[model samples]
Target: MSKGKDSPAKDGKRKSKFSDAADSPKKSKKASTSANAAASSSTSKAGSGQATLSVKGSGSSFKQLSKSGAAFASFADYNPAPSTKFSIYRADGLPDETGASTNDTDERLLLAGETDTMAYVGNNFEFGSSSEARGYTGHYMVGVYDPSSSSVTLRAVPTFQVARSIKANSSLSSISSKRTFADYGEMTAARRALGDAFGNRKQKANARNQDRMKVDTANMEVILDDFTGGIQDNLASLPSLDEVLASSTSSRPMPPANLDAKHPAEAYRISDLIPSEIFKSLPIQKLIDNVSDPEALKELLPYSKDFPAWIWSRLVDNLQRSSHLSGGSGGKKHTTFDEDEDEAASVTNAEDVMMMPALGATEDKEDAKTKVRIAYYMSLLWYIQSRPKSVSQRGKLITALKLDGEDANKRIVKAILGTFTETPANSDRAVMSAFHQTKVLAYMCALALHLDNFSVDHDKLARNCNIPPATLRELFRTLGCTASVVGGEKRMVLKTPFTLPQPRKGKAGGRK
Candidate 1:
């Protein structure tokens, strides 16, 4: 007889209350004991267009009920925060069901009011297979463990097909947002595999994060140990960081020298970040000719700080003005205007780039590296903006840029974004080579979002990418733009500035 909270919403009529855990004084203490309960999982029969998710507490202290709204947040939590505290994203590449998610900025109509504790498993649920559907599900696949009891169980029926799931694509997500991890062991493994990233710097400080629970989706059930008494013993038993770092030191390559140093090229013109080849293209040349103030775009990118307003304005102007050029392959004959443009950006053949001497100087190597870093970033920006969605995913586009960052580029690029395999790699690395290009894209995207300014237009991003944005949002999060709205209308805010760790004070200095 209940309208919605206890009963399912039938038509477009009624929706349930979006509930939060309001624990009583006695239950609050009891909730802490259950926080680390060893959790297991089992999938029920999932037929076409129908599913049921049930969470039952095995603890005698807890009651058996059909819908215990208060019991939802009694367990664990995630950083990227799943749609429902009890919800399971299970897989990595699921579609963004903002309707069933806890999105404050969501503009979708859902079966029921969604929150951290509840979601809908009714008819009319839809997720598709497009480039839009493949990347960043905007959902972090994680399972919470109940620490108060011996174990808890999470069950779900499947609705969507498995999209592209790069289980090892750990670098492309938040510290807690991994591919598919159910329990504490898997969660810990996922964290270490996250390797290095700016996103990992600030972890969500919650005692729940420290709580241990078993979450294994592959198997129907996970039998976790009795971790209620003390998980600290388990944590202490784990390998030390110093031991891990020392072991990885031999495998880890040396870092680059001076990344922020001024290059001889800066004396010529700071905007020379663009590569020599194809820089003479009329469209590219327009950036300089049409600019009112050079200083607007003069900051020279790859810096996570807020960029000049003019920089993004010029970039948008160029992209919007050149929509026809989005898919154009370079063979078009140039007009007379191209000849009179910046001489430094003269169009060069592949041979020229190859023969471009590895500029000499023990005194000038840092500058050379800096110049390379800048040029690669510029080249990547131009490539992504001017290219089509198909090419963007493929490794060939990045290969064509051919601008190497020497030693530091890889490390810097990795720090910014671990990997972006727009396309599949054969035997070598994954679509990861695209990390350099993605790092450049992330920098530009975050920079456009001024600190003083809260949001940046999403449709403009779609226009710039030459395709409606989807999983690339993960790249944005990897750098600094933590949260984004689900739909394309609202602006994506840049709350945190993307920053790299300052070099330790102890390191030896280079020749001044």
Candidate 2:
């Protein structure tokens, strides 16, 4: 999504270990050279003459007018080089009648010799972008360029409007206008601070009639209708089934052949994406029970929300070398809750001490503390989930003291879909270069979470993510939607529901 490069880190950002899916603000690159810098350079070259320069903005889309064959056909071909060498004075150049009352050519000032000292910088000197140049000075730089070009041309120099000194001509009078301010309908601070979500409840009578987006929002309405003779939806195009049946009495509708007798599909929940074996294998629960400070995690809940749900999955990876989770066989050992808790208590003092030697990795004592903190955070979430159910008449979730109050079994899921795992390139297990970064994967996962019924246009998402339409279509198909094009816009439509991969019941590493 960063155009094959990593986004630059933002300053003063609160980064955490639980942020494998969090998006970091990227520093935008700005052009270094500006008109002020150019002006200074030109002034130094002029040696007190103060070389005048003005940039005029021009629309490059004017080339479409060439279809009429009437614009700029008589003008000579202009050289499109970056920089050109020329003397200060030239006889054949456009006449410079600026700052003069006479229209005579002899009155124009011209300088000869020292052609090497005066190099006219062509339009492309500042990466061929006129907007950046214009931004440095609050003025447009106009000149002939290809479709999107804007530069100072030799012809425009004669008409350049240089800034002139302003002198006071009259004394000011202490007068005030009769009208003060107009009554514009603007929001008050209290009302504006409440935002659009305040008191926005919809009546049952105005319930949505459609389930999915049928077309791109910019191109057409969600429900396309026509009223040539009478108001009708797209279904009006099809002939009635009764009319077809009446046309031929002998023709009967064929019954569906359910010879195979396939069973119905099971409903999939958001929790099924990650394997349960991972939670069982990890000893985070043990850390929660044995750690002394449960309040630390309670305080960290707000910060932990900075990360997406998938970030919890990365704990397993970041703690690969932690003494708490590591075992003798390089695999986690199965133990009862009490046994793990006792073991956790024994290592409480060693949380700050590195029990294992570092094998060229940063994971050590700090990771041990991290593992405990993660458990504490998980315990806090469990505590929040275990609260008594409350029907709040006012306020919202994520508000102060607000609670979901449901059965507490929200096991976090590792990102198996739209996630990347790197391996040796030639080992035949390497994941191809795709949406591999943390922010991009999280962005895509958020999109997945927003989809309810299907049939979605991801043009805006694809453009923002820097993904090609075809590539996004394939990704959508991989994410459970059938890729399609409705009204020239790519859409993802769900027919048969997609199910995440899970092991059979009663099997090892299966969800029990």
Candidate 3:
């Protein structure tokens, strides 16, 4: 994003490797001279009390606006002619790296016919003087080129004057890594001690999280949600590729040009996006296994009665999709309701009570893993739909849902249905039960949606959730879910919703 003709190095320290030969000292000489001359003339007028510089536009993007519109407009038209003079010094211009040339070049040069001494200017300067003037000998300048239109302009002297005062013999001493015997040993030792202490604290936290991954499955779910959420937010907020391409039109202001092409928008295409440590940090396999069993998850969420019901509903919706139960992909399976079921049930009530959607007339006879893959694909769709329009709006909605939960669980439950993935399949008892009984469902959805790009830290995830990965794995297995892909090798697709088992297998059988 550097504005210079050449880009900077990785650490933003060295000059850009791609900088053109045009950026060399020779090319800059003419403009530098013009700038210096303009600066000198303005300074002379101001010193003689003939004119005063007026500065404005401080603390804003448009800094130093001119007093008159015409003057400001004409300022853009200001261009200098190329200089013919050459610098007395070598390529770098300065006589020695010590920077002593600034003072010695003019004042102590003891050159003939010299009355007053001058100093070497900034990064840009030209070796030239007016016909009647006498000053510095080591000065230099170069011309500025416009490659796009094949044009060139001389530097304005005013720019040179400003450059001289602000640049030139400025020392890099503060940032130099080069050390000397003059440095205090005790100060260095103290700084290192403090840094070690902070590093140890961080290591301890990492170790603790690593330990938690062994026993805590629920916490892993939460961590996954955080990671997923962060990535999605970043993705949603990033400027599109087209927007970035548009910036390449001009060279005046720099663009964020160094972005890697491989990292373009779709993060799913990259495998490295999911860190190996993420698998170790959470019980991903466990959750994928247990996504089917409604009964087990029912008991897991009872302790947190205050958990928002909508979040739970969203989770169930996601789980259903992940299990391939939301949309029918394979066989037609009939979902029959009781003969006494009411037609006038409220929409919220409709969601609370699982209905057999006419679409899923056939069931997918796939194994647990296939089911899980299907569920994951379905859940991804649901997650995107359930995400809040904006962070602030989502926060406000969550706050309202929480307050509703405290007042009436049913109120919260109704709100939960509103956030469910817009699936066509009817909800079953298992889905409703899972949402009603546990907040884990909702938390998992948030985690997946948030950290879709990154890998989970299983240990941290499990510790925070207070559930073992093994247990989650069992739950999903019971529910008929998998962690793998359900359909195409290129992408995942959710197949169908999970089927709830009645109290007992009766004479009527599963279809009856």
lDDT against true structure, model 2: 0.31
Candidate 2 residue lDDT tens string, 1-512: 11113211111012111121111111112211243254334433432211223222223222232222111111123332335322233222433345433432221212222122232222211322222433431222122321111111211121111111112311222222332343122333344345433534352222222223334467344234333334444567766896775554223111111123221111222223223443343335433442334344334343233332222222222233344444332433222111122343343332233222212223344544443333323333322222212102112222322223322222221122112234454553433233233323332432232221245465544443344667655555444456677657666654443432232358677666
Judged by lDDT relative to the true structure, which candidate is superior, 1 or 2? 1
Off by over 4 Å in 3: 1-274, 284-295, 298-303, 308-311, 325-512
Q: What TM-score, over all chains together, does every model reach?
A: 0.21, 0.17, 0.17
Task: Give the Cα lDDT of each candidate.
Answer: 0.33, 0.31, 0.32
Q: Give the C-alpha miss distance for residue 101 in model 2, angstroms.
A: 99
Q: Per-residue alpha-carbon lDDT of model 1 for 364-408, expressed as tens digits?
A: 323323323333344355444444342432334333433244443
Residue 282 in model 1: lDDT: 17
> Candidate 1 local accuracy as lDDT?
0.33
Q: Order the numbered candidates by lDDT, best leading.
A: 1, 3, 2
Q: Which stretches of candidate 1 lie over 4 Å from their true place?
A: 1-399, 402-426, 429-444, 450-454, 469-490, 495-512
Of 1 and 3, the candidate ahead on lDDT is 1
- Clash number by candidate, in order: 14, 7, 79
Backbone clashes counted, model 2 = 7
Candidate 1 global TM-score: 0.21
